[model samples]
Target chain A: MRGDTPFIAGDWGTSNLRLWLCGADGTVLDRADGPGVAAVPGRAEAAFLDATAAWRAADGPLPALFCGMVGSTIGWVEAAYHPCPANVGSLASGLTRFTALGATMAIIPGLSTRNPQGAPDVMRGEETQILGALASHPDLGIGRRLLCLPGTHAKWVLLRDGTVVMFQTGFSGELFALLRGHSVLGRGTDGLLPQIGPAFIQGVQRSLTSAPLPHLLFEARSRQLLEGMSAQDALSFLSGLVIGADVVGGIAMAADGLDGPVTLVASPILTDAYAAALAATGRDTVALDGGELALAGLLSVRAAILS
Target chain B: MRGDTPFIAGDWGTSNLRLWLCGADGTVLDRADGPGVAAVPGRAEAAFLDATAAWRAADGPLPALFCGMVGSTIGWVEAAYHPCPANVGSLASGLTRFTALGATMAIIPGLSTRNPQGAPDVMRGEETQILGALASHPDLGIGRRLLCLPGTHAKWVLLRDGTVVMFQTGFSGELFALLRGHSVLGRGTDGLLPQIGPAFIQGVQRSLTSAPLPHLLFEARSRQLLEGMSAQDALSFLSGLVIGADVVGGIAMAADGLDGPVTLVASPILTDAYAAALAATGRDTVALDGGELALAGLLSVRAAILS
Candidate 1:
């Protein structure tokens, strides 16, 4: 066992588990990654330990703070959710205690939702990213900001005064992967996204409205196969639908209204995909870096653990 | 040579290739199924010969009548298209002849699109089914009937006055498979489709006209995952969306504007699924036996060859 730092932070998602060794200042001095909780299933604790065992020292204890899905019910430990209008504490205060490699380890809390009448919709991982984004960009922390973290389960969260007001999720990416890679449309796409053009925009507009569009999709590929629409062009048309559907979903959530510019907080690829989709809607908004938010969240949880 | 038979009939599709030995009496003395045209690709002729080479010893020299994608540009040979309102003679009259098995083999023509700019969507194999159906159900030959052939590529053919008026295709079956097998919803479903109580009808209604459905289908699994919607129930709900969407599509194609009874021609499983979907729309339909259509189609083609 080796001691490179006194603290460790981890980002756990469905497919990946990443741990970072940091000093008191929150610099990622060393990092480790493995299959996240979802991928390993019921072994969140073991997975976490395995990733950081090398960083453990024979000479005593180090404080480790965790964020992301590790705090989920299926996570390293359950981090009960704090409802909307939350604070930095709303994101970081609810702590789940644990010990690994004889080091003091704790997992941060996640957020939950109570729809009009159902059981609470809890989110353990994304809440951490929200906290990180807010801590990094204090300006976005003020007033209402629309935070879009696009992924397998793209989260559309609304925030006010650093608190999560409300949020929803979309399966856009998953749908895209299924449609283009595994579906009959897969033949029309050939693993390539169509170039964004009029077809893409038209597809977006079609997805956004309540128009009877079930039949139009038949034409998406038929046009290419029967009408000679290029394969690339056909896929671009399809991308218009997937991305367009995403924009429509996010816009619907924000129907309550937006007081500030839409602050899209996501990885570059997803953020750009959303931008393209939203562009089809003819709406403009500002984009913030997703990595920065993740960092800021680590810092926030790190401080909360020290406190 | 065995006996005198004027023609040989073949049905070649994506996964199955079937051949029939028909006498002048239109009696199927023998029948067989092998890997379809798509599987054999460029070697379709050899594959066809290999499947029926036994006939070389007899049946004299006869023309081979074939249908389906076997006549696609990518198939063994390109069959010229007979536009909508095509007849049995219309299909046979425009046939493209190619020599094979030391016999005069004439591959039946395919249907083509009316789209001026794009490729005319056509069907080689299905045309024979239509011919078969018309011959067997001459009663159905009288008026406008919707010929529903549900499969990977579901075809909706409108027949008027015993002639195919206009037709459209939907990838509904394919979409259903991909969505339920490859998407996250697939995870919630576990590859089995159950009956969707009210959520399915609700989903169908919402999808047909709702602008920006909330929860992005996380709700489908959410009800199950968080609120106890059963996997079977969720699968049913998912099935409803796809099938319901397909119905909405067919309705959209009808100039009548979502106001007609859909005659769903499919197998028992697909028929039930369609019935479940049509529940929400409250639209009634006649579900015909799939086997009857195939048999009738084969017999009709056999009779036509002798005539």
Candidate 2:
């Protein structure tokens, strides 16, 4: 665990696994990907070993750190959730450690909290990204802020003084995919990406109203039938509707209202969509790369364990 | 057409076709079913002929009247939609008449209206039911009543003096199916009907809040993961969530608040679910049999055309 000892870090989720080989100085030397925890089932150890064979060969017996669903019950080994209000130190101490394939490995525990509605909510990979963002930008750890991690299951997180408080999960991404792929609303928009234009903005605006989502969603189909909206625009409109609803719900879930710029930790595509939707609601946002934050979060955990 | 001449009346929709063999006095002698518009693309005429061959052989060539999607562009013939402020008279006048297999046929046009959101909404089979309900219970036509026809695409119709003024279509039923069959919320519930008990009532209460649906939906999963909610309860909760949202939206979409008993036209199962959800909202509902109403509606259309 010395400062100059090279190691491997990973963010393994339900769909995919990403691994980064870091030098002793915490610089990323190389990166690789393998089947996610879900893909390997009982063979997660084999998949992990094969994905890092080259790295282990070059840097013998390097310790490894992992985050996300790779620590869930279905993962290599269960890393029981770290209850909120959690931070880097708590997560580092709670890591599920074990030896497999002649290498020491630690999987970061996910975070669990009760949302404002008094329902349980959980996040695995996003906690690392949030911690990484805070560590990389120390100023963000000083005051209350809202951070949104948009993905298959978007997270709306509240941060105070570098510690994670409560957050809500929105199924907008998954719902959108299901509707677009399996519902009648997606009749003609096959293999087409959502276009963020007037239709999308209109959908966002519509979502802000008092109309229930199930009612508003019908407009995606009705508009095409009556208004002659193109298939691409209908898809875009559908996208806006779901994302807009998520953003609206997220803002309401935030405590004391969002008085500051919300930090968005996501890939560029999601970032753009979220930023646009947030802007439509008269809110400001600061964007950060999710991968970079995950790496930084891992490094912070490494530093914590070492200290 | 004479008053004592036997005729065939049908409610042909997207999924299935139900036909009633009516005596000259409008009494139903027998009933048969056939494939819907979606099932027999270009072979609608052939399917219709095959389904009614036995009846035709016994009664000779009888005139037929049909309603619902049988009039859509995809049906046997495009019975163009009758615009808003439609009544029995309007629907009868708008019927698309034709001759098929040496028998005269007339298809009742669907109703089209722009919702309060200024978006076009259309209904095919429900319009017939609404008109039939009004014809059957004349008292319901005297005032401003909200009639909810719950089905695959639930419709909330605003009736004024027996005329269909404006209505909104809620995709709740379709959405519920999609989520239950394909989404993560439906994960472990295989072929189980939603039990409308505490979980469903709780979901309905939850939907009445300001929270966005995509966020509230995740509770179905989180509760199972953390609170030990059974798969059946999760499915029931999901159903309540969608249906409750639809009711809330329908109330909002109503030109005036629901001040009277909302008339529910649906099958027994849907009636029980909708009635329970509506009751939870402090709204009184009067349930009617959908089949009886559809038949009554078709008979009313015949009377309108004859007059």
Candidate 3:
């Protein structure tokens, strides 16, 4: 089915648009990118064409599906956000279509949850990974499961019988940046944690406990100024705080008693940190690569539509 | 009683020191400042003398006492920190003596608590205000109460019948500065929150319930860029989140179902913000000006030793 399509995968985000030219077997033939959703609101299609100008096949009529934030309100086309308890069944509403670079493109919608008294919770990019997860783990598509997706956002998502039952997002990256640069706890030393002694692990364990996080953070500076905890140690402590919070909070909400095996889809660094946190909590997890999941997800969606 | 002794009230923190000269009746007669604990160690008495060189009187022994971080480990002289449960019966630790400006000076020690885990919960300059609260509102010292002294480091303190039960610190002001300068939400309008209209109130309200505060901040910014929430309003939203979190998370543990009123001691602007938060939560509070409370505390401690 993908033979009719020139290429199959796209990871569209707030800041960048990445598209691939693939063979029928999904092998990378070529690739092109341009100003992402952030730069082009009304002219997303035009921008994509402009970027892919000379390389785009003259008469391919290639049909490609896009994933990530492209389906957001700010994307090339808006895709209706599917709510939690979302699976293949909840994917129908809030779909927007558009033509860009002479290729038929569809943006995938994220998920949403209506808070009882405030704004609703909404997401844009992680849905692709869920589809990919379902593709690789066929047994998980129809069962209770916990999926942890890591990035600027670390989402702890729960699935009940293949449907996303609930989800929560934490600002682990933002916190890491804030603590590393702006906060007193930040040590100016870069790449200090991943190469050190037990500092990183110590921080992970320290943050794993349920002590009020902020109170624990105050010590990051106080110890340095008072009891002499070093800046490097402080940085690790801060990192631990964010990672610990994400792992503990996300796991608590997503695992719901750890009834199911956990699947973590993220970069290696993140997986290592999560593994460290898991060890502290005496829990085990399955770590998967982000790129692989992303490709698998796009292929699955394309197959479902063609059928 | 109102004789020749010079009265001094101090606002001491970890970084700097400010002292007010007063008559026995607590009337302001002059003012001075010093390098504080951080700038110089083992030389607090000398630096203090230098700052007050112009104001030093040739009269009888200038009986002067000081508070703040000046008495911390890095300050002029370390005062003997007393364990809390500080009732009127047992005043905060006695002031230690030091030679400064060729005169007798007393440095008031902060209060510290020994947790069950054996870690010390310490307070320096803030103990002066707590002492003042006990002197001014004896009823507050008689039972379990929550006292909020809002400033750079807003301390939410709990007391059980005059014993310092426990306390937590929230850096609302420090956070305000960090967010205003470092983060994307830093583009706030100049000055206090009251000038910002509903954005200020709404911001504070949002912080109380916002799931992940940092992520929610983008809405404050983008709502203006894409949805038109206003720049000044966006800034206020950021402020509200920090202040609101200060109010909610700072006391989440100490004030849970605990009976009695919340007493707030801070400047006018912060007091108003706290009042707004209290109103949002349907909790009425007794707000006393920070300067006045510190003065009251200085006098009470002065009387205890002088008599």
Candidate 4:
């Protein structure tokens, strides 16, 4: 066995698994992608073995650290939730341990908090990403800030001194997809959410108003039928409206409000739309790459474990 | 051909067509159901012909009055929209006429209005039902009232002196189905919306608060996973939330601020949920059957034509 001690970092989610084989210096030496926990069900043991077979073969079973839904109830190991006011340290402090298929592994626990309404809210993977973002950009560690992670379930984190004080989840991205796939608003256009267009800009502007979302959503089709808006534009407009609502709604729910420019942890595709939406609302944003932050978050967890 | 001048009343919407062969006095002699305009496209004429062939043979192609999306641009004939501040008289006066395939037919025009933001809004079938509601219960013509028509696209009409002064459309029902069929909120539940349960009642209560809808929606799943909310109850809760949002949101948009108890024109399945939501919000409701009103609206159109 080539025993130089290269470690494995994984961001396993509901849909897919991403593994980064990193050298001692945290430089990626190799990578592997495989079916996510959801995709493999009871076969997660075999799936993991198959996915990282090469890495395990090259090095003699490196100790792996994982984050995301991999630690969820439906995931590899049911990692208990660490209640909030949780920070990166708290998450790293509570790792669920397991030994399977000749490899030792650990999963970072998710964060749990009661919303203002006292309803329990939980996030599995996003917490790890947020921590990673915090670690990657040390500047974000200062002051009270709003951190937005846009996705199927977009999270708006209220951070104070590098700890997640409270957070809100919006079903904006998933609802946008649901509307596009199943509603009349979805009619008349291809579903790809292109860059921010005029229709999308209109949606963002409308979101700043007091109009009800259920009513405002109908505009996607009404604008098309009455104004002769193209279907493609309608798709972008739908996206903008959903995102805009999230931003506007999220801001109102923030206990401290946004004290400074919001930090956006998003992929490239989402960067422009969210930036434009934020700009429209007269707010500034700092964009950070989500993939990079996720990797960094996992690496941070590894450090916490090794130390 | 036997001819007693019996009239045909048709409610043609996007997905299905429901028709009644009524006696001279507006009593239902027979009924027929077929695919809606969206289902048959260019074949609408032939489909209508096939749907009512037996009745046509007996009644010798009596005068037929149609309402709903059959009058939309995408329907049988592009019946023009009668602008709001419109009444039964205006709608009846704006019938688009056509003769095709051995039948004299007229489609009652839909109504159009600009939202407070000047965005163009239009409704076809619901307008007819509102008129029919007025015709069926003459008491409803007095003073000011709020009329709610719950369906795929629920409509809230502001009625003053028997005229529809303005209206708003909510995608609540459509959104409910979309979420149920295609969203994570849809998970952990059978899609059937049961009667008002504790989960549903909880949703209605939640809607009355200032919680953002996009955020509140995630509770459908969160409640399930965290609080042991059942799938069936989650479905009902989802329904309650959507309906609650529409009612609460619709009230805020009402220019006259609901002069009296709202009149909910809904099918049986939607009646309890909407009524409960309205009640929870400290409002009373007068329930009316949508189907009967649709038939009455068609009869009113026939009277408007013959008179």
Q: DockQ: which candidate is best?
A: 2
What is the TM-score of each predicted model, taking all chains together?
A: 0.84, 0.97, 0.77, 0.95
Top-down TM-score ranking: 2, 4, 1, 3
Looking at model 2, the pairs that clash are: none
lDDT of every model, 2 decimals: 0.66, 0.89, 0.66, 0.81
Instruction: Give the local distance difference test score of model 3.
Output: 0.66
Note the DockQ of each predicted structure. 0.31, 0.84, 0.22, 0.70
The per-residue C-alpha lDDT of model 3 at residue B59 equals 43
Which pairs clash inside model 4? Answer: B189-B231
Tell me the docking grade of candidate 4: medium
- CA shift of A260, model 2, Å: 3.6
Tell me what fraction of the real C-alpha contacts between chains A and B each candidate also makes: 0.42, 0.85, 0.09, 0.65
Per-residue lDDT for B297 in model 1?
68
For candidate 2, give the DockQ.
Answer: 0.84
Model 3 lDDT tens row, A110-206: 7775322244455677877887888888877765778788777666677777777777666567656766777655655566664223666666665
Query: Which candidate would rank higher by lDDT, 2 or 3?
Result: 2
Tell the DockQ for candidate 1: 0.31
Residues A1-307, candidate 4: write the lDDT tens digits: 1124687888999998999999876789988999989898878778888998887777767767888888877788889878889887788788888887666788888888886655778888888898888888887788788888999988888888888987888888888878887788887556465458777888888877766688788888877777788788888888888888888867765545656788888897787788889889878888888977789888877666566
TM-score attained by model 3: 0.77
Candidate 2's TM-score on the B chain? 0.96
Give me the candidate number with maximum TM-score: 2
Look at candidate 3 and give me any clashing residue pairs: A80-A94, A85-A164, B12-B68, B12-B69, B85-B163, B85-B164, B204-B240
Query: For residue A212, what is the lDDT in candidate 3?
Result: 40
